[model samples]
Target chain A: MNDSPVLRVRNLTRRFAAGVVLKSLDLTIERGEFVALLGRSGSGKTTLLRTLAGLDEVSEGDVQVSPESTVVYQEPRLFPWKRVWHNVALGVRTPDARRRAEAALGEVELAHRLNAWPLTLSGGEAQRVALARALIREPELLLLDEPFASLDALTRTRMQGLVGDLWARHRPAVLLVTHDIDEALLLADRVLVLSEGRLEADLRVDLPRPRDDGETRFVHLRRTLRTALGVTDKQAIAA
Target chain B: MLDAVLAQGSRIGLGGNARTTTGQVAPRPRRALHLHLGSMRRLVSPLLLLAVWQAASSTGLVSAQTLASPLQIMLTARDLLNDGTLTHNLAVSLVRAGVGLGLAIVIGVSLALVAGLSRIGEDLVDAPIQMLRTIPVLALVPMFILWFGIGEMPKILLVTLGATFPIYLNLYKGIRAIDPKLLEAARTLGLTHGETVRHVILPGALPDLLVGLRFSVGISWLMLVVAEQVNANAGIGHMMMDAEDFLRTDIILVGMLVYALFGLASDQGVRLLERRLLVWRPQAHRRG
Candidate 1:
């Protein structure tokens, strides 16, 4: 992998009509790095993700990212009218597009759903198709916007495993914006907590791959992130 | 949230239906015998109503002059069929409706595309159309007759005018109602403007267009009825008008039956088209 940063945002700021959502925020994501952003609701996590995905405008400062990047949203956003394979192959230009689609779907374990309509797929299956679509682009940067947040506990855990596996294989620079502390530690190389407009915490994990929630360091980091987000131990226990 | 809901919903729907192929509307697999029996049960009331009408007419409880018996109407229909008056007039009426509806689809869809896609286009096309659509277009037949001289032109024009609004209104609304998230997805996927319109905008808007088409076709027939009543023409309405001069209620009733049959048949045709075109919508497969 290249040593250069895949994304660089220097004193980036974004404002809406109501007020400033992000003010003088600076961050950099190196190529092949995995970063998980944890933030409370309405803490401009969405605004930052949108800015990274090129879906929103920057009102101030420099924001530079690799042109070859894609996002997998919390929702699948698959076209209900399109078949699974076709949804994955959309805008893909290749002489062997069908073969590529089949291969991509195979990665997501949706090979059996090649001709199945998107609406026919269950929620987990649909999100898998969304993953296949993003991966087909062979992006340098992958932005996952809480892709498993809505899934039931079993499905969410399975999806998290799948995402980690895919990341291992592709080694794309991934920025996962999520609320789950356990999820962040399990997947990311670095954990950043965005409270208000600024990133308040940038903790690097030195743990090995497939880190367990039961591990001592994992528990310590989880408690630290919770504190950074202003959650007391008693309050966290009550919840 | 939509993903979570759809996942849960589909998981529930997938129980015992994993073997079924995609997007066909039975939430559960239906047995063939049950389907046939269900259809038969639903048909009972309509057949019973027909039987009651036929019985009242056969016993001479209702006079032929006041109201033709179903038997008399059937006999008159056979006579008209044998002599080819019914065939020729029916053929003429079909041509008018078909041609008028064809034109309406073309004009309405083009206008809707123009108005629905852009702000400038909406500004240019929507105002005049909104004003024109408010005026019950069947009321324009007299003016159309004067301008176009009560020939095929005026009749076809009336049908075209009457049929256009529903398609325009429904399709325009469909365009506006497309999920914005899908468009955002399309943009990220790198679809060009034309490609986005073709794949995303068109398919997304089609359900409404079909809804409009059903109304437009029904409106076309209504307009044709009025159009044929006005002048020297070869149509089902003209045949009915001639029967009135000779006080042939049986032939007039036959004409009315022909109109009703065609109306029902055309509506069924649109419904079939809906089933085929919108196979993606699970609701389209439901009996209701």
Candidate 2:
């Protein structure tokens, strides 16, 4: 593994027509680190992710990331005209691109759907294919833009577990932007809450692997995150 | 979603069983009625019109010289066929239509791509095409005859002019209507512009292009009918005019029927081409 950080953002400022969405933000994600960003709906989380993905330009500051980075959006965004394996192998240039794509689909447990159209896949299956597509690039940095927010509870849990497993295996530096407190707590090595376009809280999760809901540390961290997001103990308890 | 798929599966299963049960339980009279309904759906109007025509002919409601009877028309058709005049004229008209439509496809597709893919090309090519398309090609027959003389050239050119617009317009719309999101995805995936055109834009535009082809083929035949009327010596229109001069209304009816059959045949040909080319479309696989 490289000694340098996988991504470095310095004094990043993003301005929109309305006003400044992000004001001189700074963040660094080291190699193999899992960082989760929590924010309100309009708190510039997507803007930051898009910036890192090279989908948006920053008004000021510098962003340095590995060239082999890939982003997965909330919607699968797979080409509806392409089949499953073809979507995964979109940019692969090897002679065995088909085999590599099929293998990636197998990692997502969709090998049977190699030839299936993107339109026919269920929502969960589509998201899994999106994951396969991102991972097939073997990216050194993976940027996720609320990828699980659209899934149902059951599928979301399964997808969270899948992400955890894949992260353990591939060890890519991941930056996940989401609004769900539990999701951030469960998967991230460190969680940062964005409020008013700046970091509000930087909390670390020291909980053990396969952490359960019954763990006191996990609960404590959840409470801290909720408070940072302006949710009181009463609302937390109700939730 | 899985529930919906399962429900659909069960419905199809039950439908199959229900069809079998109905087939066994239905009596002979009901079966006959069903058969009769199927035939009546297609044949009723034509049979009724034929009966009316027969009554008019037998009762001398109209003279044969004015409006040929159905029997007279049929006999005339048999006579033309035996004399080989109908076959020769039909062959000539078909060749003219084929050559004209072929040229139209080439020119229309070339112009549509040049305009649809680039801003400067569109600015240069689209205005003139838009203006030309609005001037009905039939009205240009006299001009065409004067320009190209009273040979096969003017007739073929008329069909070409008539057929080109539908293809160009539909194909242009199709190229523009491709989803931008898909194009963005292709760009992010690092496909070159040429590759994108081959693998994405063309396939996406194929359905509309096929529709345009159907329209152009229809227009080609319509133009042929008119173009062949311009002092033609050997085509279907010429034969019809000759029959009219001699008061052979039966032969004129025969010519009209031949034109209708040819139009129907060309339309069917296009439909078959559409089905073969557009098999990727999901709706194309669905039965009525």
Candidate 3:
């Protein structure tokens, strides 16, 4: 899997009139690898994801990825006027669009809501539908930007499990941007932390499969990650 | 607790049978027949007002000739219908309104697309359109008459002028109000500019555009009535003007009623089209 990088970023930088959001950064993601980007607000995590998705132009650097890449945004961003089935099948309409949409919805456990309007969906359901829409394209790469941020605690955990299950099934290389450390720890094989537009830490999670949050190793890893992020136990208590 | 409260409430209506709570009593759905009957009952007020008007004229409280009774207006309407005058005038008014409205929609939507999408286009056209929108449709009557003469052209142009601005303004607002994230998503999905406009912008703008079209249709009907009355012509408005000259109050009243009915009918047509086109939108309350 590590023989060649599926996506390579070299000196990727993005700047706005406000200031430089992502200063010269380089990262290479191997095929079928799940990578979680951890960052604080305005840490250029979303900017980098958008640039990779080709939704935003980079100020400097090269992002070389396959053209068959799809992004799931923070918001579901489904067309309000389209039904759940239609929204999932957006842009890739063929004779099999309905069949593919139904399969995707089934994968997200929203098969019963195929004909329901987008406006009627709950936040979690909508985001699941958004994920289904992105996954239906069968892309070589998938970029997710805080896709489960709006979900409640239980729903967010369930979605993290769902993402893990999907990654196991599809084996598509995923680059996910998230602020939640536990979510990054649970989902990513490796997590990269960004601070002030620079990669602060790159750590590999060597935990065993079917990892439990209550396990001693997971707890120790979380503490280590917190320390590396410069958040002391006192600061964690204060928060 | 909620179940206990519901049980107690149900017991009050059913002679204190606790076992009744265990059995699900399906709700008796209200019939559409009863709903229709209720609506008919609500129409009594309008009927009473008409009856009062009829009685006042019959009792000579007001001169019958000055203010025609409902019966007299109905009789005049029957006479006009028999002679085909009413249908002829109605057809004329409808044709003018239809042509004018079609033209307005095409021009309004095209211009709105240009103005809404391109910054340079908006800057160049927005001020001029705003200026034109401020000018009353009636104020353009003389100018249209001079340009196209007192034929059907002037009347159609008047309706067009009245209908254009609302559609343009609403369409532009709808386009601008689309969520930027949705457009970005489309770009990421590899949608070209034309495809994005077709798939994203058009559907996003449709609801507002349909609402604007409803308003525009009403405006067209109003302006058409006034425009048809401008010259010696054959229309409901012209008929009313002629009847007023001859002191035929019943015919004048009938003409006014026809104008009101036509306006309502055109508006309803627009609403029906909106319903068919925007099947995804929830049903909203509207007056008949």
- The number of the candidate with the highest TM-score is 1
lDDT by residue (tens digit), candidate 2, B129-218:
887765656668889988999999999988887778777887887788888866765655556788778777887777667667777777
A11-115 per-residue lDDT for model 3 (tens digits): 988889999998899999888888999888888898888788887776699889878789998889988788999888878857898899999999999999999
Candidate 2 stretches with Cα past 4 Å from truth are: A232-239, B1-39, B285-288
List ranges where model 3 is wrong by over 4 Å: A1-3, A93-95, A237-239, B1-48, B282-288
Best candidate, lDDT: 1
Computed on C-alphas against the true complex, the DockQ of each candidate is 0.56, 0.26, 0.50
True contacts kept of each: 0.41, 0.14, 0.62
Give the runs in model 1 whose Cα sits over 4 Å from its true position: A1-3, B1-61, B283-288
Interface RMSD of each: 1.0, 2.6, 1.5
Task: Report each candidate's C-alpha RMSD, comma-separated, in the order given.
Answer: 7.4, 9.3, 11.1
Error of 3 at A164 (Å): 0.7
The residue-level lDDT of candidate 1 at A177 comes to 98
Ranking by TM-score: 1, 3, 2
For model 2, how does the per-residue alpha-carbon lDDT over A1-239 read when each residue is reduced to its tens digit? 55899899999999989999898998999889999999998988988887887778766999998887888888888866567898898778888999999998999899999998777789999999999998888888998889998999999999999999999999999999999988898899999999888989888888888878668888888888888999898876797
